[model samples]
Target: MACAQAYAADTFVIKDIRVDGLQRTEPGTVFTYLPFRVGDQYTPELGAAAIRALFATGLFKNVSIRTTGNVITVVIEERPVIANVDFVGTKEFSKKDLVTSLKQVGLGDAQPYNQALIERAEQELKQQYLAKGYYAAQVTTTVTPLERNRVDVTFNVQEGGIAKIRALRIVGNHAFSESTLLDQFSLSTPGWLTWYTKADQYSRAKLNADLESLRSYYQDRGYLDFRIDSTQVALSPDKSSISITINVHEGAKYVVSGYELEGNYLGLDNEFRALVKLKPGDTYSAKALNDSVKAMVEKFGVYGYAFARVQPAPQIDRKTHEVSFSIQADPGRRIYVRHIDIGGNTRTSDKVIRREFRQFEDAWYDADRIKLSRDRVDRLGFFQNVQMGTQEVPGTSDEVDLDMQVKEKPTGLLGLGVGFSSANSVSFNASVSQDNIFGSGNNVSLSLDTSHYYRTIALSSTNPYFTQDGISRTLNVYYRTIRPYTSQGNNYKIVTPGVNVQFGVPFTEIDRVFFGAGFEEYSLNLAPGAPASYISYVNEFGETAHGFPLSVGWQRDSRNSALVPTDGRYQRANMDYSPFGSLRYVRATYQYQQFFPLSRFTDVAFNGEVGWAHGLNGRPLPVFKYLYAGGIGTVRGFQQSSLGPHDAQGNALGGAKMLVGDFEYQFPFPGTGVDKSIRMSTFLDSGYVWGENEPLHLADMRAAVGIGVAWISPIGPLKFSIAHPIRTRPGDQTQTFQFTVGTAF
Candidate 1:
């Protein structure tokens, strides 16, 4: 009894707790988890509990509790601050990726260093590897303590070669040939070049993916009840090679008899019935029914009923071998917006985002306004993603709040690139630009471009709201020297300085009109081999011309998102005429772009443009003012400015009138995890150019179809295309391919 009392007496009231090596964590953040307070009695049990809790925070290296007389001290050795994290042998994800993922699991800078975190991270990585079919992947993590109580972490990973689909066997597919059934799987036989292709060593992930592929394949072909029963992946003794076997069940398919509309439509029954597109004799497609319901919901939303709900009920008749769908609509009470919340903007100011909002506080919630707001934010091009949703404000029955989230992208960028084509020669361009411009709504860019035919240096700036009345202004100054490829000796240089100011006049919640004009002083020097047509225009417009290029333009863009548009039409029309000013020409151009979403990751775009530049009041069109085509933005199979008139030596003579038509089928790159960062497109471009007196000929027009890659690079969108001429004429130079930079369509 005496010994027990002595042991109990050794433990006393706690004095204080001290934390060391804390670089990112606050002391108060740690104190909340301690088991004993300053005046509370301390015991071995309590000390152990406190240590466990501290470790659970994942922030400490060592935790100890000691007592002296009636006072107790809780001493903690904080885990080293994560000074830096680095990864090697990783092309699968960017550095930002691991940082964000680790932060979510509480293992970032200033976070506790419990061994459990490291273990969890390792396991998670291995799981990801497994998902990628790296069955034998090995991952190891190491923490190296550095000076200043910080630490550097390295994830030593042996990702191993990706497992491929060596051999696939369909065990339960007796009705079909084994080979035929296996061919339906995306995972295929190991080619002789599997070292590079690596399509064959099977793993669980590949097997699962192939299972889904198989189900879809059969389902689309009338196998309504098709399913993958089970799959087995067997590995070789060395664990390097694998084989897979799948069991599937195929069942009878059904067709739709028709669709019926039920429930109240609030006097919109006929309107809602037309929204249902499913018809008799059509296959029983769940997807079709779902789409019909969603379309109806959107239709209701357009009426200011933002909280509409839609549900579809499908009825099956076994005897008749038919299916019928009944779509139900519920348009809830219309509510007004109380507030708008902006989130996920770590660097940009809220005003910058809010300025793009079309929906206002205390206004009836308009679904169109919400969509327009999202589109406007996306068009800013400052974020990789823009998402907006409504959050029902609790305790309020008549109003809801809006929350907009954005993922900021790098604003400052530097890049150097070079390209060569028959028309442009070897073109090298480099630049430095910042769109955000030091957190203000401004832009600054400097570019130095060199081509075999021309050399240019340009500086430009734009102030979004130069006069506070939303009057945006842009200033551009550039100097360029052109070396003509013409045999004639008329090569010259040009220097241009221009400024434009545009004002926005708001008309409606989602409508704005702007009118602007600019004056540019252009100094032109004639190049050699010039045609009579060209010399005549230049002689009339002359050496150094200063003109007020007056113009009025209007644009209306309605889309869900800008980078990856789901649905919208962008229309712009402008007319610029030199009336009583510098040069002698009148130019009018109009363009329309329509975006249709074929799927979540695919967009079909239709673009058309018409431009006419005619001499004003008997004055000839300026030579420099003529339109040039055949490049990234025009015909893809021809060189830059090569589509227009050409002299005997092939020097291009610009034209006064032009028309362009483009159709692009854009789809996301397979296996590229990023949805907006990259896109692959197949396009058809057709256009022609004609002089004022020259007659347009269909035989002289150009058309091409090809594939290209589009990347939303940090600098800007970079487009590279390789095309093949679809229609070739005899004696014509079949320009079969072309590559270019910037957004072409």
Candidate 2:
């Protein structure tokens, strides 16, 4: 067929139109591409345009337009459809992912196959491999004609070796050492942890993030004018090695001259001014400045100024190298919450989250209440992320909507494992728990443990909001058997079965009071080599004893994070009274924990606990309820529960009074920068237990120094300690190393 240019000079008025060489395309479709209809004057330009438009649709491989007297003729050869798409020799990415990538770029089965699209897809595939460090990757596309005017497209890929970083150099750094600045980066040259962290792989995204970190590091240290000039990344000839060079400029350090608050503060100027953390003559810190702005804005939000804006304008003086900050505030129209929208909670019930919110619908917007609600929801441990966003209500200037977006996480835990510790040489444990059972905001757990010296089965349930006032109810039933000093031929076992109910009443945002009652039955099984204390207890109180125990407790926690607390205080005071039991006694305990962050990567923690128990109504306290302190949870330089008085057979005889104190300095694990989940600590622990009727004295206290590690692992939290006794008695039992798994310390 001749091309459309053969009749470029001809012009005519078409009385009829005809389309030829149409296999799957309709005549109407071809007519739609023509610039002239029947009875319309058709010229050389219109005929050429008709051909070009049909070809531009990518549906035709060849197009021709000609004139037959007064009738215009159009002919086109349609492109073949893609019958199938396939990939070969792809390992870096899955076949499904590759196909999806191709589809996203208009190259897939059943679509009109074009050679240009095939080439573009191949290039894109190669780029994806390059991003993953496969610098030598190769991609090629092949098209094969199939039946029914269709074709098959195949992508062949060869993924080669990964490019590793060989050297990293930072230039023009003076305010801080090169090593110090490099340590702040997440990317690095080959190292021991490179395999896990993938820090040795050169990534554009990682480099960008590292550069931002470097900028923040300088800005936070008074280098307000610091800048990253340029970054150069070079790959080796073999495409297997990479070298990075970062150029930076560290301007002169500046000190804060002063700060001024600008704009109306709604009659709370003094309150807002007090939120500023920066002071005159102090090193200018970007973090402090930003925090001040955030504080002021949040204060405005407390008064329903949801759209308030607080910005810091810095005035720099190069002569004196001093900077002053002027904070500007703009509180827009007061906002009232029109609606409280909840979203992204696929598994959790709305009630579970709504009850946690202190802010109510149709109320004035309060930033403090919304923040507290977010925190409370986070503390529930039911979601991976909780975010709050404000959206303007349509057609309303002073009304806004609060959207609480939550990403739910797995709340059900099934644990089955075997572990070894110095105390319980080997133990097998299994547990099933659901923190948000059925999305009803209730907790249920069943646990069973089988150890060499102890066996237990427990079932518990807790309703966090049993009442509208935020009162929690908990019920527990448990059975435990404990064998004391079984390795030393003391085969005595105490079996206890008990049930308890408790209620937690919220007194303040961070304080709660708990009251509970329990019924317990204890039976002693005396073997041939039972301890003397067990025999004496049986002789005095009989083989079996029952008790009705009542408990009252108070707790206050203000930690920033429940999992890894770096700042705040935790305190607890509890009392237990067995006034209606054969064993009449009273026990009281007080505990205090405080954490102080020394720097971004280090913290100091202190813990202190004291307990005392006394017999009443001429009946001795139950031996099973005695206080024992040692091992992983207390003074680590001693055997498990062995820091107290002993029976005639040298078995551990737990005491009625106990005291423990621990001081620790925790730092991040080496090579795992900024990861708080894994930490190392050097600690000093002192504790002791006194027998019944024994007077408490400081001389009897034991002390130890140790090093420990805490890691939050996939299975659970793990803690290990190695210590040496600094003060010991002749009869004291010492354990140099102890560890516990599947539990928190």
Candidate 3:
């Protein structure tokens, strides 16, 4: 007992921590788990804490704390390292998916395995199944010890029957009828066409998202105090049926009252007051009121009030249900820029953005100039993120700093893909593009395509800052050959090569005016099945040694974001005339697209395109320049390049006029994290080609209904679709499929 007391009294102080049995981990890592560093007191609590912390790392199976009187030591027997990972009976996700999901919970390649990680991974997997309505799913994790202190893991999952939404019942909604609320929910009992929509499945994620949508719908329209009171989910005894209840609180609506303004406005009161778009007797809208305040502050910015504030005071008249707002402007400490910091660009050069800035460091701040700067940067199309922030500088009341950051993405792309169908038989295309060419303010692209009857090569370039004066310019050079179908195999090939340069001057932020001119030459070769109408035109007016083509266009693209547009309008109208070229022709095309946001995940887009080509100077327009449709970009249900005038053999004989329309609904993925990168879409595509005197008719046009999946992969966008022809003639096929390996634009 005396020796034991003496040994206990001589407690060891840690000289240093030496960790062993670590392969994938570092020694310093173990030190972070140790409570006592070098030259510290070690107690029983500290020893226990060290063991627990080591175990929490999920890197060890057994952690032992021992002390030999004056020398305390910690020893750990790490779990066998992961030698391999395998999945069994999992078709919902791939092996890489399982690996990624397991790694999140601590089990990964080259990492030590612990029972705790296995339990966590099992729980996660079960939760995922529950989200998909698989409440009775079973997941088992087995660890097999291997050689070299490693272990292999296998996850066995037996996903049972998926719980379905047996019924949907609404309770506690007194103001509105139960039927009204039921229409808002996407999840419902199976209907006659449930096999297609899958509304019968009850998903927790879907329910939660729907509830949020409901809340937003009420709040945005003046239910400022809307709240989701509670939600309850119940499963039947058999675990095959699920029931959900959502309780909501809809508060009373409030009206705006008259208000008065205070705070001093330095010689800018009239200008700022004019910005208040709201007046007395208007409905109370928090969104509109907030926008008015921002507008007032922005007006003050013109006078160098970078740090301006607008406070709105409202006086409510309960009896009259009217409200008036009084606004006050505070121009606090007009500051000059001291420094500017640019960040977040990993692949693009900083100079590329700095060149677009209209506001300079050390100059007085201007809101309009700053907004223009942002627009210029966003137009680059090479970044995924862009933000600007201002910070006040200490010790100086009239100085501030600005910081701008951008996230960069790949700027160059080259893609090649082929498609084969019964109609087209075989088609191939290649494209080389650079969105941001050499860090310069230009976009350049070259494209080539060839089939049995047609061949085309085109080069295009666009400069955003054309003349060092902020104007935009675009240049194009195209060489194309077309072989007309003939009964005697004597169809002729028309070769047309031309170049165009267009200069654009912005009329406003949303509109631009473009003017350009070019030269072209057209020559024909005799081939089989040549059409009489086309042959006469080529022989009369299409045989030109040199001709001049002049054009003028107007464009307005005010879409919020070009990659995935919502809530904006894109309009373009152009007319071209080649009077002196190999052929005398005049052509005109007009396109319009409008996007309406139905919800965060839903959008309604309407697009229409019309083209008209005519012969001039007593000659017919060459058929080689005729319009073609019924492809991925045109009508979706029919084979690509399959729409136009057809011969006895069902071969296309080009046309002079065309029109098309598109209506699409893009669906969002629940867990993909690729908000803008992956989307599922359904579209209705209709269009048809016409002869000069051919009458237009709804019956002659073909329409298709289809669904497709688009992914912005590392290489490029991968789009695949399967469509069915809704209106087809007896001889026409009813179904088709297509895929494109690049950006849809």
Candidate 4:
């Protein structure tokens, strides 16, 4: 029906068929598309039909049919195959990516060449650059013929300058200033931070998001009738710059005049009523109302109503600027989970994650258990993301399936580097830590230090599933040799080696108890000019001593995050007692930490720790086990382990009691957006260490106030602080600036 040329011929008895002018297409392919057979009759109508059939295949550029005697002949020119597809002047996108885009449109290497497809590709390329703010971009395509019916396609592009926002303006604001309203926008005009923030770039997605932010700002501040009337993004004729204008209608503000419940809350009206957060006289806030409704739904979900329907019915009184609302609820039929499906955990075993889940298949849906399950899995820190969902079983109203998905991340570290902690003068070290060994949920670590002042080796292992009931077991072995007092001709050294075993039992989701026992020995060899403090210790307790110590601890952590907590409380208490052996003493320590979320982008944290040790069985606490403080983890601006009493040689003498307190206020760093990983904070730190015979005095504590920056960088967590000591006595070692960087090998 779509013949390009007419066929004029007379009917004849056919004897054979022939095809000509095909370089790559076989003769049989042409026969398959022909309307007439070798022995069939050939007429003018039949010849036209044959021509149309062959042309529809798209394999040929030209098709014609002729009849001679009883034989029919077809002549065709096969379309050229695309030999290559390339681009020039395309600096905005990679060539491989562009090729992929072209392939989706049937225009790529080895594809049939068509002028229509080539035009489409050129337009598509221009559209892509437009989306990236390149309004002046241009694209042109060319087709080059080659021997053997082949062709090469080329796209030439000119990616112009990215249009930037020159100005942004907000209109129709009567109650709030323009500057105040813009605080909620993610989009901004060009500024000093343009290079990193790219705030000047104009994209439809960014503009939409900024408009939503502006709308939420008004809604949260009691403007219930607020609406965005119009928005205009204007581009300059030259296409080098753009400008945005927003017009908002902030209607009358409303207050919560009254509210009531109208729906069946499953006879739990008392529980549902307590969840209402709005007061009659308070200004209406969209966020608070949404949260209250969400809480009510979750409460219903706890009773197996997975498909509960909750709606807010509001009554508006325009004259009085007041709003009244009622929550309408419909409790769907109780549903049971038909299956518990886990996915996206390729490296970790199914059992390792399933054991931590509280929700199970064929059980009544419980929101609390599901939430706890998700939190526990998230707290493992083995995944980058975890998500949960429920899907109703097809044809089953009362059955649903629980879906848990996770995104796995590296839970081990292996590195070789020449890095050191800020407190150390010179250092090189190697360490390996695997928190999820072989994806079995066990942990092990080994660290070796060969610094100039000391040499050390330590190994630790933990089995979190030691008893299958969540009881954990840990073992640690360490050996260290200290040569701080060594010189060119005289060498004084202290050798110590120890091993410990510990077990942990969880009493609740947020609390745990630990108990352990260990054996430790100390051997010190004194030189002729040994420090007086070391000589005194050797004279008092001899050169060799060992102890078998028992330890007990209680820990509770309710933080929402382990690495960068915004709000929560954490506490830990530990005590070690040595009732017998040459070295006998009791040491105890307690730490309490609290984080308060001030706003979405700011927080406050407070930390307090105290420790005390005393000798038992008429023996002094060993100098090695004494409590020490005054460092980055303790009171900043002071030397590490240098806050205790000092001897005539100005050497720090370990103390029996220690106290440290730290307070910090964290906020967003400029040009970083809302990323909590990088933050700036100002802090106050104070601590002190008292000797065994010295009396506790608050006046003796050293305090410092400083500012710092914390970033979870590519390699690890890094902190740099500049602190100034405010209280110090004679012989106090102070440091004005300090930083800490981890080393790995």
Candidate 5:
């Protein structure tokens, strides 16, 4: 009875309620948290609950509820709002990044201030530094009170030096040498190239990747039971260096006994079995097994089995040291594509992308067609990345939707450049090109080039899809003036202006045919020291000449990548005929290129080219149209345009027949394993040019061996080589080094 009286004394019926200390916070916000309102009965428990709820809002630092004569009074002290946030002494991370990180943790400006959040921010900053190998980094926070019930926050950071790797060791490596295994790791003890490659830096992510490489190396060599036992990373007492140790166990090697196929194979068991790369009595290889599985899965996907699963179950015979695999496949129900959604093309038109799609909507999902579509879009060279994903349609079991997400890259280029070459000495060039003009998938270009030997201005445009059947049309107009780089004692010049129109028709997926017609006018200027042959030609024909040139060509390309091909064949045959001109002749050229991949990072490439020009209607071939060899693109050991027949005055006279062959073994640059952007090659080059009536002979060929580097740099593509001529005559001009910059080869 005494407890009941005490509780009743603290209870009351509220007639009105009032909240105090409402700076920055509305009174209605306080009322929303109150448990009881006016005209409602309030007990001591209810009043205590209201006070707790208001404090939990984080807006108030203190809260008190009291009642006098049936009226409730709430007293609160609001927490100070953050007026500004700033950083000091931070260098490793940008200010925007820190602010964004803090905002994610509810510590930005205009938010209520709290000491706990400041501690969290400091801890996060330290963790970020630690990830970057800054073990001794420090962070401090400061809060300064300001007017209008606000405060300013500042974070000061001190980023210490990066911890480098001092030592690296491997344990229990028997089949392979320790040095050989260490060579596969990106991280290493300090070495000569560490300053540039940063290979001596200690990083958890790099360590993990190295561990995976180590595992793959063993597994690919028949070590079926290889395992990494443990890894230890230790830092020096001063936190300036780190040491890493990796322990591995290699079990017994095994050989493949046989393989079996299990599960439904869509009535193509023999086809699926033939896709296996493994053979009986061969060494066991995880890579081969994965390749066989991937091939089988893709085969199923070709038949519209979009959701297919293939698993390998290996059986081990420990006594015989043999292993067998049971490949199990479960191809789900055949799916039909309902829709294809394309996104991330902010500037390109829908038709521009849609025309490249080989897989149509409302069709059975074909993986091969989808892949072809993606490749075609990529070949347009207007996007940085193109990704495709499948989404299951809602309320449908055997239907799916495809989403193609592309990241657009700049396709318009306006460039001005200056360069130096052994042949031309100095050159200046300017160009304006738009590959995807106005997102209409049309190409337009205007260019001007000036050099010691040549000067030219050109304008060109192309429409890849001029018709619905994917035919392409191109138009080009140009005016060019050319002078011999070294003409003995003669000064001769030729000015030519031309316009051409061409059409490209696709005959097959990898083949195209082109036909074009050009109208050109040529004017010649000759000074003293001109050759007798040139004077005879001028006497026979007038100074100015006009011609109508017709061209036909065929090209077939099967390279996996257009920019850097590893395994493929490319062939081209072209012919040009001038039927109505003072110079009546026919010229033809054939070229073939073959690339064979030796491994994932190495390749052997071969190129052969042959050209011939003959006079028609008993007319002589034009001297300006003759072919010349020996340069960066021909034989690297000889001077540019210096490998042909010489005139009586010791000047270069280009030939009517040419032959060139090149063989190269290419690999990634040192310390840049598997990076295709920078490559090194050892090459053998042979080529020669013949006179108008000279017979082709292998004895006249010029051969050279060289080492070269190709780099796809940010500024442009660059190639340089140093060569030694194998056989040279007294008149042959030899150049030990040759290079080209700002060229796309």
Candidate 6:
């Protein structure tokens, strides 16, 4: 409210100035904003301007200026500062998150409280809840005055039940059935699994994505004139359910007549024409046309044309439903890289990443080299995102700069496991690893397993840039003991201690060769209930043996991602030989894996492995060096290492020959949308281990079929499978379920 006595029509500032009704603001502060000081004459206009200026500062809610005998008096009231902002009945979003969002809207603690701002905050909070499908939520704000001209703000919310998608209908989709079209949508009616997937909730963003998918489905299948006419969403009166309807037009399909290159392709018209994927008799597909244009542009980039442009002009015949297209390409000026800039590598040294770049500064831009550099950096497994782009230099059309940016992620892994047997015995396992230790691009790991029947500890370290030529050196030391568990209570054990050093040389961008040497000492201990095979081996090998092992290996990997690859091929082969030791033998193993993309969200992967060993220098292969098959990494639905020969006590004796194969179809988990970090796969696995003297037969291989879930979680990678053995032998041991909580290659 204004003062009882208003400002006089005539104003004067001849003698002095006095400010009243100020609780926190000082009198001098008001004078600073006053247009007229005591020494200057004051008119009614100047007095009104001073009041307007003081009000603009937001420091005072009310102000009045009056004059009594050439003296000026200014009365003001200050707005209260918000002392606290609190939320009540908020369960969907954390209070901290709400506070951060409020600060962005200028309505946080210490800010002057305003009714309009409070109203906006209430509406925004309601919007946040609505985005999560909580359409019936309510929000009410209260402001309470406090001491020292402060106030407390509180938002009371009643978040009702989430609105569900009850009905979904598609109209005018002739080429595809309604059910097929609905399958492409992410939203659906409530199902048994909706409690976990939440697919039955109505989200505007998901709805929009479904619309795009519907459009693409037709356009990619030669419906050149396909279009989504309109969409309608309706909510129930109770606001607890939603229904959506989408209307679309599936136009007539068209066939390609032909394609021609009309623009200058740098005198390489034939080369550019070969890149076109649309054949003359094939159906006209938008996907194929877009792919052709993209390929042409990338081809130009390969020749240093950074600003290449490619566009397709389509000519259609409505009468015959035929289309012909002409591709126009303009190879822009050739660009030279003036500089290269690296950013967002706070945890990793610049040298560690710079060494991986094949593109050099002051050279012509090569798209292939730039792409290779980006992939190499991403393959380091230290960053979540890596991006590279060319920024044209100012005042120069032929010069550009390469900007590389990365978003670093945690490169540390912590693994833990716990299991219980039928006899109530518990086993524990753990491992700690860091791939980029201390930001030096070094790797170190320690692993331990504590089980009543088996125990082991291993430590390893690697320096990726040990020689500064992209060569890597690694050292490994380990101790292991194995005591097989059987129904007859086998009381024998084997212990081995070993050390090794290895070095890797890069043969190509995707290939590497590795060599290593190691020394291992083994000892066998027996009790009264030991297995017959173990006792016989102990007698023949004299209970203790030493081996000097040498190893050579080669690998070629072209996977798009190391942790979760959707496509690529990986092949690795390794050989180990102990030529001059008591346990002289040679062992070789080869593995091949390839992934095929079946659709945007589906892939098929096949993995095959084979191993063989034999005596060398007139000595038999070491029993400890024999290969074992079955279990999660080999054949699921079978006991670990239980597919080979057995002793008198029915304990498995690992075989000298092993073969395993796995075929899996991977897809995103239902309701996950496009998130690839979590997915599901169906697998068919078959393998068997054979004794050195036994005949190898394909019919003898054991097989199993199963389903599994793979998750790249915050802690580590996790995999769980439930399988049923389809080709089990009479004495085979089967385990229907298995899970692992670490990375698997």
Point out the higher-scoring one by lDDT: 2 or 5. Answer: 2
> TM-score of the candidate numbered 3?
0.71
lDDT of 1: 0.70
Off by over 4 Å in 4: 1-3, 9-15, 41-59, 337-351, 360-363, 391-401, 415-424, 483-492, 527-530, 630-632, 635-639, 648-650, 665-686, 693-745
lDDT of 3 by residue, 310-408 (tens): 887766555564567777777887778888788887656787788778788889888888877887788778876778888889998888888888887
Error of 5 at 145 (Å): 4.6
Output the number of the TM-score-best candidate.
6
Better of 2 and 6 by TM-score: 6
Q: Model 6 off-target regions past 4 Å? A: 1-6, 11-13, 57-61, 77-89, 95-118, 140-156, 192-199, 203-206, 394-396, 419-426, 437-440, 463-472, 485-490, 617-619, 736-745
For all predicted structures, in order, the TM-scores are 0.70, 0.83, 0.71, 0.88, 0.85, 0.90
Ranking by lDDT: 2, 6, 5, 4, 3, 1
Of 1 and 2, the candidate ranking higher by lDDT = 2
Show the lowest summed lDDT stretch of 10 residues, model 3: 1-10
| lDDT values, one for every candidate | 0.70, 0.87, 0.74, 0.83, 0.85, 0.86
Residues 1-745 of candidate 4: C-alpha lDDT, one tens digit per residue: 2235545556886798888788988888888977777667767887777777877777788887765656666777788999999999988799999999888878888887888788888888887888877899988887899999999988888888988889899999999999988877777888898767777888899889988888888888789889999999899999999989999999999999999987789998989989988879888888888888899889988998888888887788989999899888898799898898999999988888898998888899999899989988988878888999988789989999989999997887653334222344344456778888899999999888775545689999999888978989999999987654122213357789999999999999899999999999989887765667678889988999899999999999999888788899999999999887887899999999999999988999999999999989777778777888876689888766678787666556669999999999989777797888789899999999999999999988999899999887667666788888888887776766765554322
lDDT of 1 by residue, 209-280 (tens): 777767766755545667878877787665566777777887667788877776668798888887776778
